[model samples]
Target: MKYSREELEEAKRQIDSTLHKLRETIKTFEAKEEKARYKSQITLAKRRVKAFEIANYFIEEAMEK
Candidate 1:
């Protein structure tokens, strides 16, 4: 699917926001006293963070081209 420059820019902004929130969530989960209880949730958030980072990289590349 071909995305326009404006659309790609908006998507990048949204992904950036989501990535920041996900990182904060991971930090919060790790800081909890019973960190083991949220282990699965933390892992899920970490995976999402990685995915978003990859997506952002693609978006930037698209914009460059």
Candidate 2:
């Protein structure tokens, strides 16, 4: 499928928003005893961070192309 520049820009905004939410979630879960309860949340945040990184990579690649 082909994407317009505007579409990619919107996708990038969504990825950034999701990453921001994940970061906030991680902060909310930051407590010594709640670590166990928040393990999954932390993992999700990690994955989101990775996805953010990958999204940025694609954005750069496409811009370069």
Candidate 3:
């Protein structure tokens, strides 16, 4: 399905907001006294951040097209 430009813009905004929150979460995880406790969660969040970044890139490319 083809999305309207407005919809694509909104999607990008949402992804940006999510990425910001995820980064904050990673920071908070790292700041813990026992960093090892959050290691798995941190790793998962980092992977998610990367995946979202790729998704956002694709969205931008689609918008360009």
**Which candidate comes out best when scored by TM-score?**
1
Candidate 3 lDDT by residue in tens digits, 10-45: 999999999999999999999999999999999999
Compose the digit string of candidate 2's lDDT tens values, residues 1-65.
Answer: 76778888888888888888877888878755768887887887888889897987797677566
Q: Please report the TM-score between candidate 2 and the true structure.
A: 0.77
Candidate 1, poorest ten consecutive residues by summed lDDT: 49-58
The predictions' CA RMSDs to the true structure, in order, are 0.5, 1.8, 0.7
Would you list the rank order by TM-score, best first?
A: 1, 3, 2
lDDT at 1, model 2? 70
lDDT of 2: 0.80
RMSD of 2: 1.8
Q: TM-score for every candidate vs. truth?
A: 0.97, 0.77, 0.95
- The clash number for model 1 is 0
The model with the greater lDDT, 1 or 3, is 1
Candidate 3 global CA lDDT score: 0.96
Considering every candidate listed, which one attains the maximal lDDT?
1
Cα deviation of 1, candidate 2, in Å: 3.0
Candidate ranking under lDDT, highest first, comes to 1, 3, 2
